[model samples]
Target: MQDYRNESEQFDRIVSIGMFEHVGHKNYREYMNVANRCLKDDGLFLLHTIGKT
Candidate 1:
C-alpha cells in the first residue's frame, strides 16, 4: 500500500479521540509532525486521551 504521509492535501481539522495512547511516547514527535504537516495553517487539531491516577 502507498504511504499516506506523502499525500499533498492538508486537512482543515484533525481529531484524535482514544487514539493518542496507541501512538506511544517514542513516536509522539513523529506523530505530531505528521499532524502538523497534514493540517492547514488555520486548521484545528484536537486530541482526546484517557488519564489514570
Candidate 2:
C-alpha cells in the first residue's frame, strides 16, 4: 500500500477498505493526501472503516 501513492499515475476509483483505522487520528490528513494524489480529478473515493464501538 505504501507503494501506491508514490506512483505518477492516477486511478479512476480508489477504495480503502479497513485501513483507515490503522493510521492515527493526527495522520488522517496525510493519509487522505496520499489517496488524493492517487485519485484522478473526476475519480471516486470510498473509505470504509468501522467506528469506535
Steric clashes per prediction: 0, 0
If scored against the real structure, what TM-score would every candidate get? 0.78, 0.79
* Superposed model 2: Cα runs more than 4 Å off: 1-8
Candidate 2 C-alpha error for residue 22, in Å:
0.3
lDDT scores of the candidates, listed in order: 0.82, 0.84
10 residues in a row with least lDDT, candidate 2: 1-10
lDDT of 2 by residue, 1-53 (tens): 55543666689998989888888688799889988988899999999998985
Q: Pull out the clashing pairs in model 2.
A: none
Worst lDDT run of 10 residues, candidate 1, spans 1-10
Superposed model 1: Cα runs more than 4 Å off: 1-8
lDDT of 1 at 7: 62
For model 1, name the residue pairs that clash.
none
TM-score of 1: 0.78
